[model samples]
Target: MEVLGRDRGSVMSVAASGISATSFASINAAGKVTLWDVRLQHKDCMSVTTDINMLSGAEATDLLLAADMHVAVALAGGAIIAYDLRQQGVLSVYNHTCDNEAFLAGTHPPAEQTTLIADENGAIMPFDLKQCRPTAHLSDRFFGTSTTISATSFGALSNICCGLGFIRPEGEKPLLCAMGMDGSGALYTDPQLTPSGFSLLQESDLVEASGKVLNPPLPISASFLEGYVAIGRANGMYSIAVPVANSTLFEVLAAPGHACNGLSVLEWTRGDRPRLLTCSVCGVVSLWDVMPLVLETPEGDEVIDEDLPSLDVAESVRDAVGQQVSVNCGAVIGDNLLVVGDAMGFITSCLLV
Candidate 1:
């Protein structure tokens, strides 16, 4: 394991390109984004600074690799900037009028050109890369005409929308999962942009509500792994079946004791079995064997088996710096290298055992 130190500020976000895993992007608390080439001994290949005055007290929230050698940054002020590595300056910047802070930004997996940005109000907007503008607001498109309007709208309804992920099931259209600030979540499938309609799935509809107001699990991050949506929450980690039907609630997974702040799903094959790499706020990194259990009922519906086998934590690594810093984000680069960003302004690269 190798630890890299940064003196600028806390590393807020990290993203690795699908086209070239050796290249990765990271944003710091000071709104400085840097692209690094891990193959070149983690050298800073490029760097840029966003408008700090326009941030309005908000930090850089998310970073993503939109295309080959292209990086997109989502600011807390709802500004999305696309940067090309070959270019000297930013390629383009799209500004959206968001009442709340932006939380996450990503591109649709199937259509890599379509960019999606999620905010604190639970609003998800789809942006066209070519046009450099938002295509539609997902909440308005999905449930604008419903009688129970507010319930369908994620706008400041709960704490905030913390995480978002796209799942592509075999022989089916892509599905989008939005994890609310609290434990509540929702799913959208077969989304249409023209008419703006989709099949919706809500957590309230699947699980019986417990009216207790104690400390509910707050999802901090999420990802699609091994045909399931893995959610990293304050209490523990949980996984729900993708393309969620009416039967499955999030199944809890035994994880680190502290809050799970970030997660990265790497495709790994261990004797035909799938696995994943998970990291937590307390700087606990673990490897798990993924085995999803699904049973076909007589009613011609699929349901997750109650006695699903628990994921085994095959390996674990604690804090490399030993300063008790939170791992804000992480990504897997190359074959077996794991790079992570911490709240203490340190980027560490680990060679998996």
Candidate 2:
């Protein structure tokens, strides 16, 4: 396996480009976005950096793969920016001025043209990429759902989206899926019913299990499996289920795990069953297979580390690519090819057996 590496800043997130499978992008805490081409030995193809001071802990960024090779980044400065990948630079640094809170998360499904940008306080705004501005929010239409309530009223993990996806509602467009603090996931979006935009679809109001409070959903990836988002349960359990959905689609029952710092969906291994991986601080990776996971998909898919090996990541990385640092985020190229960003601002791509 050929392991190749490159250093940028410190990547906070990395995902495959919606436009190209061999291409991906990574963003650092300081709002530096670096584009990489896996075909070029994982070399840095292009990059854009904001003027934020890296140590100030302000003006942070989260990414959404917008349409037409454009990446949307949410900033703590209450503004959203769009970068045109084809031009190898930013198209709109201030695409939209949002609410007064930090924009925490964003998601744009491949089928949709609008991107849902959520704030730290949970209020979500739909930005029409074609129009380049914030569209009507679901709350403006007076829709009532657990997700909207969580966002407005601040209900634990409900508003701070770790991941975003959609469910195929019986409408022209699918319902937007978001998590509720409890297991009662919520879905929104109905064209005929609510012409203005969306409505309260449904909330999965689940009770506490065994009297044990369920951990809030952590960082998530919507690309691992169709119709599902892999969540790192705050309890360190890895789950391959739609976030806050009524049912737990899949969870690997196993020993308790380290607090998952990150979770990325990697179905790159040549097989029918795609895999979900979780990494803790310094990049401790654990893998799970879904074919063995059942249909009713049990709960407590522990996102633990004991089941997997947390070998010294820095040393392992040094041996693999000669650069030793904690892994920040990752992206997969082809079947068996792995690419990751490290604490030292390095991006590495290699074939992992």
Best-matching candidate per TM-score? 1
lDDT tens per residue, model 2, 153-263: 222224444444454412233445554333333444532232122111122212255654344343343333444544554445454443233322333433333444433
Model 1 deviation from native, Cα RMSD in Å:
6.8
Clashing residue pairs, backbone N/CA/C < 3 A, model 1: 160-181
lDDT score for residue 205 of model 1:
31
TM-scores, each model vs. reference:
0.72, 0.63
- Which regions in candidate 1 have their CA more than 4 angstroms from the true location? 5-7, 55-57, 99-111, 136-159, 192-215, 242-273, 292-318
Best prediction by lDDT? 1
Residue 80 of candidate 2: its Cα lDDT?
61
Please give the RMSD of candidate 2 to the true structure: 8.1
- Cα RMSD to the true fold for all candidates: 6.8, 8.1
